[model samples]
Target: MSRLIYMGFKLLEPYEGKLSRTVLRGESGSNPADLPDKAIASPLMANYILYLYKTMRKFWGEPIVVTQELGDILGNAVIKDSILASSDTICLLDQSKFRGNYEQVAKLLALNEVEQRKIFTINGLDNKAGRGKFKEVYIKRGNIGEVYGVEVSLFQYLTFTTEKPEKTAVESYVARFGSYSAGLEAFVSDLRSSRLGLADFIMQVNAE
Candidate 1:
C-alpha cells in the first residue's frame, strides 16, 4: 500500500472497535501507537471520527449491541443535547477582569445593594468542591476562544468581602463567574473606567 494509505489505515485501525461487528479476530486488538512513525497522522490533521471511535469503544464497550430481546434495562442514557445546553445555565460570581472603565460595574452594583446580592449567590452550584457557600456578581461577554465546538469569550470582575478575605474565596468566586455574561459586563465596565489604579484593580480581580 502507499505510505498515505498506510498512515490512514494506522490512524483508523485503532478506532474500528467502535463499529458493531462480530470480530473473528480479538475485538479489542487495536493499537495506533504500534504503527510506525511514518504511519501516524499529524497532530493537527488527526481525524476526530477516529478519536471518537477509540474513545467510545474504550468508554462504552468492545460491543455496543443492545441485545434486549430478554434483558432488563439498568439505567437511563444521558442525552447529548442536554449536556450541550447545560453550560448556558452557569452564572457569573466575579467582578474582576473588567479593567479601566469596567470599574463602573462595581459602582453600578453597589448602587443597588439588593440587585448586587441577587447577582451574588449566597450558595454556589453543586460540583466537585461541594455546594458554593458565597455568591458572585458579574457581567457577561462571549467566549474568549474555541474548544470542542464551544467559544469562551466571556470576561468578569469579582469581589467577595467577608470578615477576613482569603485567597481561596477570590479563586472560588472567579472560577464560578469567570465564563458568563455577568462576568463579561464587569470586565467591560472596568476597561471603560480608565481610572488611576485601575491596573491594580484588574490585577486584584484576576490575581489567583
Candidate 2:
C-alpha cells in the first residue's frame, strides 16, 4: 500500500476577530449584502494562508489531508475555506475522533503502520522557543508521529517579501533554530529544500 502524507500548518496566535469582513463577505450561508461596503475586510493572516495554499500546491501537490485543532481560535471559517480550496479531504482534529484513551489524534487517524510513519505536521512556531522545543521533544517521544516546526515569522516575511519588497525583514529567521535565510532567493531555496523531506518520504512510499 502507498503511504499517504498529510501536511498542514498551525497558527501560533489565535484568530480573535482579526479576519476582515471583506473575505467573509461571500461565504456560503452568510449574507454580505446586509452589511455596509466598508464594514468588512480580510486580515493579513488570511492573505498569508492563501499564499501558503498556493505554495504547498505548487511545491508539494495538493495535501491529502488538512487538519486543524478542534476549538482552536485559529480554526475559523476563513481558514477552513482556504484549506478546502486546496484539497477536499479535511480532517478536523478533535477529542472525539480518537479511540480509547489515546490522546494523539494523528495516531488514531493513521489507517496503518505506513500511514502512521508518513504523517507529517508543520506547526506554526511563531518565534516561540518553548513551543518549538516541545515539538522537538514530542517528535523524539515517537508517539504523535512526525512533526516539523515551521517559523511563522519566516513564512510571513517570505509572503510579504514576495508580494512587495522592502516591507518585511531582509533576514528571515526560523523560530528556535537560530538559522536564518537571507534574501528572497535564499529563503525560497531553503523552504524548498526543507520540504523536500516530504517529497522524499512520499517517493520512498511509492517505491515500496
Writing each residue's lDDT as its tens digit, candidate 1 over 4-81 gives 646656665654543434233435543322334432233322343334434545553332211121111111112112
User: What value does the lDDT take at residue 70 in candidate 1?
Assistant: 13
Tens digits of per-residue lDDT for model 2, 68-154: 333222334554455544443433322233335333434333334443333322233355533312222112222233444434454
lDDT of 1 at 90: 25
| Cα-based TM-score, every candidate | 0.18, 0.22
What TM-score would candidate 1 get against the native?
A: 0.18
Q: lDDT winner among the candidates? A: 1
